[model samples]
Target: MSIKPAIFLPELLRHLFKRPVTVKYPFEKEPVPKDFRGNVVFDPPKCIGCMICVNDCPAEAIEIIRVSETEKKFKMLLHNDRCIHCAQCVDSCPTKAYHMDSEYEIAAFSRRHLKIEYK
Candidate 1:
């Protein structure tokens, strides 16, 4: 097979001179669209301690701990690392305790930081 550098050179040079296609991340922030599921936000006041969200969650990221049986108080532990962000918790919660947050830049150096606790 014969090789021709001249045929590819023009196409490469044309794209090289043109402006880059990628958006400058960090320098320019992109907004999260409406109803975009980023992170799970737990509302303690709205929680009913049903554990529906915990059961429905495919990743088993949500844990509902009953703080007080008489008081009906509950604590929610959300593992961001384990969470698939499927929004199943939000949908499954009978009391609407789980909601999705707009903040998508949830990068962390340690897994401990990713764990969110709601009381």
Candidate 2:
């Protein structure tokens, strides 16, 4: 098969002068849009330990732990790896303890590090 240099020459010349379209993702982060579901944020003080979030979560990422006999001292553990970011847990919370944050940069090397604890 014969190689066509004429067809490739124009594309190569155009790319040489044109500026790159890709943004520096690691250095420059684009702003997250409104109503963007990134990650789960749990407020320990506002949480009533109702277990509503735990039941509503489709991913089963939310786990409620009993700190003592008192309901006020309950703790919550959220596994980010298992979470699908569907915002189901946030909607189910009556106290508005669970919320979705704008920050989406959640890359991690280990699964253990992705787990968030709320007390």
Candidate 3:
């Protein structure tokens, strides 16, 4: 059998002059697409605490607590570890309290860091 490796020579030579296909993610962030579903954001002033978003969320990321008879506390505990990013909560809010933000760089070293609490 021949010991000379000629097949790898062409691939090595072609890659030597080519630009890197990988992106520098930490330094350069790409803009999110218009239709891309991302993290959820809540607006307290616009929210009526109707619990529609809490009811419709498949992931059960939202929790509403009654603070008093006059006021109801809205709590959205977004556990990114469990979230599917389907944008279902945004569509279910009748008061337009929930929105899908474009900030999608949500990598974390621990699962605790991935949990976002909004009150």
Candidate 4:
């Protein structure tokens, strides 16, 4: 009896003869895409501390603490663990204070380090 050949045989052979598709990490750093949503950054000066970002964030990853009402500047804090990269805060900012940066390699064993305060 004769058996049918695999349809992926040609593709498999082509890949086998070709070079490796992946590069070694740590040794070689790849460039991130322009629109890649790696992390969020907040500009303290641009932000009026109106709490729009804190209130609009879907993941509730942002916090605005009122250090002093007389000072008129609140501390903008971010919890990376709670952030889902939804970009809601970026879109909700009235003064374009928050922006998404291309830096997704934030691996860590501790969750405390993920929390950042932009002052």
Instruction: Order the numbered candidates by lDDT, best leading.
Output: 1, 2, 4, 3
| lDDT (10s digit) by residue, model 2, range 1-119 | 88699979999999999999998998999888999999898888787778888888899999988787855776789999999999998888999888899988898999999999988
- Residue pairs in collision within model 2: none
Question: TM-scores for all candidates?
Answer: 0.78, 0.78, 0.71, 0.79
RMSD to the hidden true structure, all candidates? 3.7, 3.1, 3.6, 3.7
Candidate 4 Cα lDDT to native: 0.85
Residue pairs that clash (backbone atoms under 3 angstroms), model 1 = none
Backbone N/Cα/C clashes per model? 0, 0, 0, 0
- Once fitted onto the true fold, the runs of candidate 3 whose alpha carbons sit more than 4 angstroms away are 1-22
List residue ranges in candidate 2 displaced over 4 A: 1-20
lDDT agreement with native, every candidate:
0.89, 0.88, 0.79, 0.85
Candidate 4 lDDT, 10-117, residue by residue in tens? 888889989998887878888988888988998877867778788888888998876776776667889999999999998999999889999979877999999989
The residue-by-residue lDDT of candidate 3 on 18-86, one tens digit each, is 999998887999777898888888777677778887888898777765545866655566777778888
Q: Candidates ranked by TM-score, best first? A: 4, 1, 2, 3
Which candidate model has the greater lDDT, 3 or 4? Answer: 4
List model 1 lDDT by residue over 1-111, tens digit each.
876999989999999899988888888888879989999998898888887887899998988898886888888999999999999998888888878989889999999
Segments in model 1 whose C-alpha atoms lie over 4 Å from true places: 1-22
Q: Candidate 2 or 3, higher lDDT?
A: 2
Between candidates 1 and 4, name the one with more favorable lDDT.
1
